[model samples]
Target: MTTYKAIKLIKRPEPGPVSPDIFEVTEKELPKAGSGEILIKQRQMSLDPAMFGWMSPDTESYIPPVELNTVMRSSGVGEVVESNHPDFEVGDRVMGMMGWQEYALSDGKGINKVQADVPDETVLSVFALPGLTATQGLLNVGKPKNGETLVVTGAAGSVGSIVGQIAKAEGLTVIGVVGSEEKANWIIDELGFDGAINYKTDDLRDQLTKLTPDGVDLYFENTGGPIQDLVVERMNAHGRVVVCGMIADYDKEVPSPGPSWVPVIKKRLTIQGFTMPDHFDQIPTLLQQLTPYVMSGKIKHRSHILEGLESAIEGLNMFFTGDNKGKLIVKL
Candidate 1:
């Protein structure tokens, strides 16, 4: 009762892909809820593409590296087991940097209570970081107009899937670029996307040309690779690109070049790379805009949950491998 399970980062990962040796699953003393604090017991934690950047020692990223021998940093949905804070009561479900641990203690800062009447898995998927990223980056940055062409890379992913759906809801024509034929079908057929291109196939540019005959007015760039190069080439005048992630480059020791700027200048493209931390203050506004879509099933999601904390090490690699069928989560 005095101790709880946690996954601690014993070593920083090398300049390549995620490996099992970097983390150690161990027991830690349960944290106490001090005055003006709330203690949380984690129910489910997300495995995101951004976590790949958190693991690399040499990577200078939007956030600092997870200090060695500490609990590996993560965000999760948790139940309040104890509370001394004025704002929170016992049994309240909250979300924040609960890390790869069974319990967390906070003073009601940086955490938001889940307000929707949905399952914990749904809250963790579209209501948390993934949904916010999609909503903000697409609407605030991409700014698609009705009947315009919208293209999304990593179209089968948690963020990309929602971005396409939101664009469709706004009456934009959505074309998804995915890694597999099944993923292509999932977005186009099941998700109501106008078209899809399988990036693993050699005819990427050809497919993009055919699907986007009108040219893309907005590109939601998630996986940066040849697919992105092709998408950028097909951009219309004054096209907007929302760079949310680069899962394709996460594992490479030496990162490759992105799409050239010559075309960017000719097309007058507006490209912005976004990190969720800088946009945390806007989550409330975003949730208000995004929650209804989720509630109405207009913004749908799929979760591929692994069974335990021990699976986190391998589960993280799924983001890069395209092995994950949906939003990867670790169910504790």
Candidate 2:
């Protein structure tokens, strides 16, 4: 029997950096594909901020918490090594929620084939959750208009970068709020953002005033912190706020208080929070909306790759540290 390593959630994490002790790594005998199922040899796994919520004990989140003693939940790109299903064949490339393991067996419910010719990195980086989230949040939820000004927090991250680029493509003035000077430069110089605010060093209000002289028309909230209030204060009347991830407060015992609702009432702002799982059924439509931007060269992406499956354990901390340059993936 062939064996493969898998990580299981043995204990619920406390409010802080993820502790390695909560997970138990073990080796198990690999199983063959059963009737109407496919076996995948996962090549790359994505590390997302959402995993923190999934690991928590909260039962009211958009998705259920990963049950203790089960494989850690994650999405990955893989190739079918064996198939008992008619729709998938051996050697077919695919992507889906395969969890933190070397091999995955699925009944072909959510799994989708990777038909694009691009490398697996691109598939996981741009076309997977990042791009899908960007499209649904910015385009469907935000409803941006041409000549409007847009500010996206966590602007250099996987989803935020795509949101800024898509806003720019739609003729909006895009300003990004990033953590470091390097990220600010990359968003402005390379991603063609109108301007960037380094939340760490820059004066948040001063830079926001200078960059968005005409009040923000759309705000893409990715990281919740001090800057969130400043951005909300500068929004135009009837502006849209798309709340995505709140990484800054993810590990805290208590999340920071949200911005006052006075402005929200006075400005008549529209605010909505969304997760990709709710929009999974519309994936084909979202991909249809996002593919043109990629095919036409408007979308550009970078990936920070870690080696081996176990590397995923430490990679989760990088989200809080802002160390990973681009889409964080573990190459197995």
Candidate 3:
């Protein structure tokens, strides 16, 4: 049997406080690939805020809680080391929900054979799940129009960063909301956002009103909380909101109270929550369309790369603390 190391959650540790050692690294034998299956050696893993919700012991989400003693769920880029599948070859480069392990065996299900020539980092970063979520949500849900006003929360993150730029490319006035002035400046100055607000200090209502005098036509919400409520208040009539994620309440025992935006629904607004898997069929279209923009320098990225699997805990913590400026990736 082939041996491999994986990061597993030993228990659902209490949310409030913890030691540095949150996850345990354990070695195990790689499962043998069956017919229609493949074995992969992981290269890099995407560290996402969604992991926070998945780690909790709950039934509220569509995804079930990660059971104790199992590899932590995550997406990664890997190379096929062995395959018994007709569609795949041994040297294929792939990206999928391979969990947090050095080696993973898959049945070639829920996996995509990434273009071999694509950069390894892009496979797990901009062109992976976050990129698809951003492009699809903006196009399908947001449905932005030229000269419209668009606002994105968690603007420096993997999803929000791309959403802002894509909206800008569509000729919308893009306004970003981030946790720090540095992030705000990066989005506004570097990424071509029309304006940015530091949500940590700025009065959301006041700043938004000043930034988007026309009111918001699209709300790409990566964070849900008081910011969501504030964004709803400023939304123009018949606006659309894509609920991409809710990173704020992941660690709390009781969920933070959702925004009191129901009254604003009278304006004929559309708000929807979505997962990337629900729209996986559109990935080819997404990649074909986005790759050009990315290569042309129309799309920009900021990533925080942590070294080694041992630092995964720290990298995960950065998501919670809003410390990461862009995509948080574990370079193994």
Candidate 4:
């Protein structure tokens, strides 16, 4: 049997100087698909900010820690080579919550059918999990209305960029917040947002006051911490704040706190945090609305596709440092 390389977490360490040494790659024999199982040859893997939180041993979280000597947790697109499941077939392209391995054996639990004809890069770009996350988080939760102001942090990212575009499609005045002027220009000029604020340079409160003169109606909160605090205070009456992922504090040893939201009571603001699983049933609906726009070129997306599975760590680092624009995916 031939063995393949996999990035595995060898230890869980406290936040310390030595923590960087906790993860390593190792060769492991590829296992055969058992009955009802499908074997996947991973082509591209997603490196998200949330994966950093899952590496910690102390925090109680949505997913468990990657056990010592186990492959790191990641969502990836793969081609099925062997299948014992009736619903899946050999040569089927799929995406799922798999580990950071060249090959994976799935029992048909987390895997979803991916559009094989789409460019291999696009599967991990806008059509797969990142797209769904943005679509579900923005359209379903945001419910942005025509002429209303929709604001999003991480505006250049896969989720936020789509959120901004979708809101624009719905006739909302989209205001995007990103870390760089280059990203700001891309969001405004390329993605059709009404305005883009370079959060790294601008004073968010004053900028929001000038840009969203009527106050924000829908705030798609992606990066939390100080930015979140500012958005909360600037929300209009009956404004909705959809807390997606908090990328800002994800890699921190100590999390940053936002301003007290008790004032939201008097302002009649609606603030809610959600994960994709909360509205799993909405996935098909989101796909129906988004896929057409994507196909027709009405909706567009970008990705930073670095080559090789070894680049996954670098992708994660880019995500943490806000260096990546659009979705960050590593090709295997």
Candidate 5:
């Protein structure tokens, strides 16, 4: 009557490169919901590239670091199995920073109500951080304009994929940069992007020159590395760069040098870096703008969902390795 499975961060990742061995799933006694708190049985946990930063030692960031032996921090959707709060009901489903545990004890701060009938995939992809991130970073930061040439790195990912489609809807040309031919085709053919370049196999400069003949007006940067430098080089005057993520350097012990700022001055580029926590107040506006495209089937998404808490450790590696086809989530 008392125990449930949950994953905990057993140790911090080392200084140079990191591995998934830091996590361990174990049985823990369930905690009773006190007055004004609720008990939630988690259904799904969203996997993201941001975990890299979270696994490291504490730093000034949108969220706090995961202490050793604590439930690894994560966002999840769950149902209220028991409640001691006035606002929440026993059957109500909600989403929030529920971490990697099978059940969460919450006082209802960041949690939000979720429709029971809505597919978990949709909730995890478009409505969660992925979709909100794309909306906030691209619309608020990138500021896409009609007839502009838009380039997105990690274009096959949750945030980048949505950004490309949204830009297309707004009357801009969308070009995706992915790591494979299959992903390249998926973004262009399935996701309606105008063009796609395979960064791993294709000649980077050649493809950028051919595909972006007009130069990039807005760059939705997701992965940082040589690809980022190449994309920066192809940017046009007055271009905007929306810094969403940098999966390329996630595993590196020592971070590499970023793209030079000389181009920022010469091209007069606007470069902005953002994390979702700072923009939480804008979720409603983002959802209002993103809902129509999602309902109409314009904003398509994919996911590589792993089952159970055990896979949680392995599933995170997918983001860094490009092994996951789409959004990554751990289905409980």
Candidate 6:
């Protein structure tokens, strides 16, 4: 093909569901792999809550915002169709920041070869950003211990689900807070979470108190909502809180208030916020810690996939609505 389709950020998104007008779908001439570069035909791309931050006008975020009229930034799995890079070769599967396009040309700065014998969907859902985030936040930051209680918000989501499962495997009492009954059941029954609280239907304080009779020891914060304050209040002394994504307030004109620091002071808690970009250099080590759980059949994940590249525009709303069952991917 002489050209490929790509979506560019024409305008910054407002504080609500993403409007389609902010993105411009355009066709561009396909570029060849220049010297020491690789040409990748992206197979599937990941849709994450992090995209909201990337598209915003926030210049001080962990990573730079996507420049206006440039390809919307994202990560994806692709095949190296042509290559001049020494490490990458034609036909090799790879994953990296390929953006919101079908074809990407890389100088091999951030791209890495996919050596695992798993489907592309599995790679994006488990081994990519979601799994990496879970490992770094829960294992490294949370430092969960046996018999302790862990309450992870967005428990049915890409990162949260994996975090709960890893905690379960590590002998923690895993309780997940979800939005709907189906998600609650999936995390509790299928993913082996000790219990689940439906944030929309349940009394946050009551359910959390009943479920975590011993008090929570590790709090993996993925969604900052009303339940966030309740969970923090129930944390035991010396408890650790791993602050990941805050999806609940991502689209708000004014972000919601966080939990009070009184509990942190009284309980001697440690709260830390992390983003993947800061720990990208430690990917190899994180994978080593997370792989054993996957190999032992402890970690499980599902993909909520969109059909075409254009579908990504609407699929992002699923994060706010809690409509997606698991990891969100755009199959291009």
In candidate 3, position 249 carries an lDDT of 68
Model 5 TM-score on a 0 to 1 scale = 0.96
lDDT scores in order: 0.88, 0.94, 0.83, 0.80, 0.87, 0.93
Candidates in order, TM-scores: namely 0.97, 0.99, 0.93, 0.93, 0.96, 0.99
State the lDDT of candidate 5 residue by residue for 24-60, as single tens digits. 8789889999999999999999988888788778577
lDDT of prediction 3: 0.83
TM-score of 6: 0.99
Clashing residue pairs in candidate 3, if any?
none
Encode model 4's per-residue lDDT on 1-332: one tens digit a residue.
Answer: 89998988887745432344677978888899999999999988887766766777854676567787888998889899999999999999898787888999999886888863687668777777778888877777777888898889888988888888888888999999899999989998999998877877988778878888888889998887566777777778899999888877666688787767675986798787877755555666767877976887766778888788777755667865677766888888
lDDT of 6 by residue, 1-332 (tens): 69999999999999999999999999999998999999999999999999999999998999999999999999999999999999998999999899999999999988878877889999999989999999999988888899999999999999999999999998999999999999999998899999999999998889999999999999999989999899889999999999999999999999999899999999999999999999988987888898888888898999998999999999999999988988999999
Winner on TM-score between 4 and 6 is 6
Best lDDT among the predictions, by candidate number:
2
Better of 3 and 5 by lDDT: 5
Model 5: lDDT to the true structure: 0.87
Error of 3 at 293 (Å): 2.6
The segments of candidate 5 whose C-alpha lies over 4 angstroms from its true place after superposition are 15-20, 115-117
Against the correct fold, how does model 3 do in TM-score? 0.93
What tens-digit string does per-residue lDDT give for candidate 3 at 1-332?
A: 65778999877756653344558898898787898889998889888888876777877787888888788999989899989999899988999888888888998877888873667777666889888888888987778899999999888999999999988888999999898989988998899999998878988788989998998899998887687787888888898888889877666677788766664667788888888867777788888867777877788887788888767876777867887767888888
Q: In model 6, what is the error at residue 14, expressed in angstroms?
A: 0.6
**Stretches of candidate 6 exceeding 4 Å from the true structure:** none
Give the total clashing residue pairs for model 6: 0
Candidate 1: regions farther than 4 A off: none
lDDT preference between candidates 2 and 6, better one: 2
